[model samples]
Target: MAEREREPAGWQLEQSAPEAYERYLVPPMFAPWAERLIDATDFERDDRVLDVGCGTGIVARRITDRPGGVGTVVGLDINEKMLEVAETAAAKSQLEIEWRRGDVTDLPFSDGAFDVVLCQQALQFVTDPSAAFREMRRVLGPGGRVAASVWRPLEYNSGYVELAEALERHVGDDAETMMRSPFPEWTGEDLGTLVRDAGFSESLRTIEIGSMRYPSVEEFVRREAASSPLSEPLGNIEPDVREALIEEVRNALEDYIDDEGIVFPMESHLLTAQR
Candidate 1:
């Protein structure tokens, strides 16, 4: 039998993961942050919005539900499966959202096409986040807003940090590094730089959202294992190693659990830019 190879290192895995579980998993994990982002935008009823990298239309759906928010909301994503899920969810809510399959860096809209372009938890996956920002700027009308958020270093994100540590302990020394650096590791400064280069003036206050707390370690693990494409790669690991990884992750959570349940801290940067 031919030996299996490790998945290539880059943004491709982030762009496309063939797991329905993972794709649908993000909404619940990020519900708190998602609501905060929507509130930050203070979306108006008539704003013609474009949600870039609009995975499953979390942002898009929210906007559609806004009072007097009957204006158009166009959500674009490269993964059709994600769009499909978003479409179904949107339909259930009796909301109308135009979900299209398209790359973030290569948007299919005309210049000055939208009043606001929003992206949430998606910049990290773009091979060229700077290019994606530029595309976002191009699609926005003058004085429009570009809003985005990205996870900070794995160290600040307990879920990812623990997962990386677990992968290292069980899989190999390279596992932690590979998982930690899954996409481009960005800080607030890095995100600011990318937005500035894309021709958007960064808002002085980098609206920092509070850390997310999961009810319990088991629930946290379940959501992560189900939601992130990270699980897809585990199938490549040896079964023994995979089992060890699960145990290690469980052990790591012991430090964070309390009578109130596991309170893992997840830090991410939310920024608004004026185009």
Candidate 2:
């Protein structure tokens, strides 16, 4: 395997994973997707909104920034570190958002507490998606709606597939599993059934296609590693092993690289349901 001379500077900073996620992944990936998910639903001015699993509070912040503003936006995530980042970001933006550390399966809110519940790229990680859906429905008011987005499958997200395969080869199976966990193998029908079983009445599912770009393949691997559970594992590996992993990803994703950087198509299932 080919190796680079040195690992990129600051690659071993595992303590800043959440901050890295907000700074790196949110702009290129989550923030744009959050706009799409928010566009799919109708949010009236002053409508109470809850963003479930709101990493760094991008969706919550966006909703509050919307033209007429919203009513009582709350951002909830199980990871306190992520919530800390979310709080900091919201504070920086001078946006008033409640950051709550709570589990998705059992939300900490009263019944009919929100008019709109928005979840972006989080349902797949839930141990019990059905329970999470139930909680979403339980907290929504009469005629309220829930909007959530989940990556379609690994096959549809080519960039991540290559990255996961490279991690399996160089890092370990656990690393590959961690990388691929975001893109579940659930179909649109499967997601609809999940919401329906959770007592949501009217449901709509759509496929949203988008692109993710990185300055280079190395940056791609480095930023993704820095932002996720793979941070410590990748940082702990031998420097040469890390270089080889990046080389593998570069070779695999060559077709997607251009003058700008590495760019690849991604797909997700956007589901909206009413309670």
Candidate 3:
């Protein structure tokens, strides 16, 4: 798994977790949102951009690969392994992305350094998501735009709901809550409130729910289980317990497999605003 639990003791990804995550989790869990988040904004080629909380650089690569002059792009993530993976991808693609290992709460750049800031599905993992938004606003240039997305509450997230249910049954409530607690406890209106609290004016707030199709059921369970915060619980127990948990999740996920593949409804909330 590419996820490493963040240190000083918080729910973050482990260093070894990135490779597994990029291969298994990114395709179905995040790839669609990368396209969707970028589509939410009308970014100019020459506009300087920064992707906060970029995991494995999916959004960064897209920004750099955008036709025309998508301008300088920087990716910041607290996970070093994730940054290493991002840098490796940048080298392989020959895209000039400035990837840095840093926290979303405290950006390392000077104030007003970027014209556009994007965070794709990274807000919920932060200790203080609102503070992270404030940092995005802080480093943003005058009239800059910020686009970020968060999974709507756990209840609305089909994939996570199924996974979490299995986890609670196996790992008990403490670990289950620890991992799922990062999900925003409110709605799109609550998301808007956070944006406004960060001194940004919201232009759009929408919940995008769509079906995600994985190539196979095994890959879906492998990737989804590996990347989930629940992975820690599965990892701590004996191999048999972990396998049992995986099997339970796999059987539950079977409801999603179809003629095309493992298709299931997934949802995320997008927030686009200006600072």
Candidate 4:
């Protein structure tokens, strides 16, 4: 594979991985931050909310169930594959959320079109987060609020740390680096810098840490290996070797397993700013 193509794969998608993303990764990885990010927003009954770089409408769907009636909640993403799954999910749940195909750097909406914007764990995956932040500011009405989160770092995100360690023990450092790429630029000051560079007011950057629980190690391994962009690196290895590494990782997680499932820690830096 080309070097550029060798980067981690979640932001973009393969043909059939969307369902896996929603089924396997949403609860353990994205939903905690999604719930907290939405709660941190100053949403009103009739405010228009936009979730940029929304994956599977996790945050947008939750907005519909918030206290009062919201005017409009739109989920915008660059990947149609993701949008398709998100749309299917909304239909299945009988929720009304507008899912659109658009880039965050140049949002396909009029100026000052939304009253609030939320992005969760997506900024680091973008090639140009500064431009995306500016577009976020541009799309917001006066007194509009923005709340977003990015994974703090691999060391603080226990599940990924152990996963990366297992991959390094087998696949080498290239894969390890790709696995760890989603968490740079996540410090409170670093997050504040993002909004500052985008020409927005200083943000209140705080850390929101949560624990993720999975039913079992087997389920976690199956979903992660089958669904993530990290799967690409494993494709170059022998089946036996790959399975061995999965088993190794699963065994390592036995320490965190409880009756509820395997519990692991996760941390994200939540940044709330104004337009």
- How accurate locally is residue 162 in candidate 3, as Cα lDDT from 0 to 100? 70
Cα lDDT of model 4 by residue, 42-91, tens digit = 88888999999898889998898677868999999998988999999989
The candidate, 1 or 3, that scores higher on lDDT is 3
- Tens-digit lDDT track for model 2 on 1-275? 11342235546655589999998899989999999999999988779999999988999999988888877899999999999999999998899998899998998899999999999999999999999999999999998999999998999999999999999999999999999999999999999999999999999999999999887787888899889988888878888898899899999998998877789999999999989
Model 3 spans with C-alpha error above 4 angstroms: 1-15, 178-182, 215-217, 228-232, 236-243, 250-254
- After best superposition, candidate 4 residue 111: deviation in angstroms? 1.4
C-alpha-based local distance difference test score of model 1: 0.70
Residue range 1-275, candidate 3, lDDT tens digits: 21221111222235356876787667766777898999898798689999988989999998889777587999999988789988998899899999888998999999999999999878888878788988999999988999988887877766667767777887788666755764667688888888899999756899888776665554454455456555565545765665676678668877776655567776788889988
Q: What is candidate 1's TM-score against the reference? A: 0.82
Query: Can you give the lDDT of residue 108 in candidate 2?
Result: 88
Alpha carbon lDDT of each predicted model: 0.70, 0.91, 0.78, 0.80
Q: Give the poorly placed runs of model 2, Cα more than 4 Å off.
A: 1-10
Candidate 2 lands at a TM-score of 0.95
The candidate that wins on lDDT is 2
Query: Which segments of candidate 1 are over 4 A away from where they belong?
Result: 1-24, 172-178, 181-184, 205-219, 235-243, 259-261
| True-structure lDDT of candidate 4 | 0.80
